[model samples]
Target: MFDIKSFFKREVEKKLIDVDDYIFMPERVEMELEGGLLNCVLNSDGRVDIFYSKEGVTEVSSASRKHPFTSFETELNHGVYDDVIDDLIKEVSKIIDGSSKYFRRNKVLPSTAALPSKPPTDL
Candidate 1:
């Protein structure tokens, strides 16, 4: 009974950005967030894999295609949807705040601080 459209309408839209309907799996739901795809994949094992990705940066790909992903898991039962959503929000915040390893490697640092000590001395 996990309906993507219903979930977005009831759960995500006002709290998060209003994403266009783009559900990909019968057991999963997804939306565009912070230039990436925010996914909730409901596994047969009764766990949900919440993830974010910037690899397939397109609405169509985010909707219908596959790409490499980074994720964390959560329980799918009980009335813990709020807890799960909170954890997901924390994870996204960590990535955005540049505290996560993925963010360190993937994000472009605005400062020259991380650059090597030597620069091209010629012309």
Candidate 2:
């Protein structure tokens, strides 16, 4: 007497366990996507911190300070895994397409010093 439904459920659970293991790895996983770099770090509360930088920066501190693109936190489980992944892709695409409001640029202020009346001619 083989229970087909139970068998399939067990198989799916096994696959999910493997994915969970990878997500829980001590080292962060990184990849390049749409002219930017994406980083995933596992947090202690079973959530992942995802960061995107358009400058191709891998360091989180540098990216946050210089070119902060987009960042979010997500908890992935078997039930909502697909939905979460799809939403992540869409968000990243928005950032690359320059349509996301999260995109930011560092502003440089012009100097306020007065200019000289005559130009110095020193050859």
> In model 1, what lDDT does residue 120 have?
75
By TM-score, how accurate is candidate 1? 0.32
Q: Which regions of candidate 2 are displaced past 4 Å?
A: 1-25, 56-111, 114-123
**Please, what are the lDDT tens digits per residue for candidate 1 over residues 4-123?**
898778675454422223332336766775556667665543344666656432211112222112122222333334355555555655555555545556778687557767887885
Alpha carbon deviation, residue 36, candidate 2 (Å): 0.9
Instruction: Give the C-alpha miss distance for residue 118 in model 2, angstroms.
Output: 22
Worst 10 residues of 2 by lDDT: 61-70
Which candidate gets the maximum TM-score versus the true structure?
2
lDDT of 2 by residue, 1-123 (tens): 999999999997776654334323333656765666666665533455556666433323211111111122232222223344345566656655564355446645568989989898894
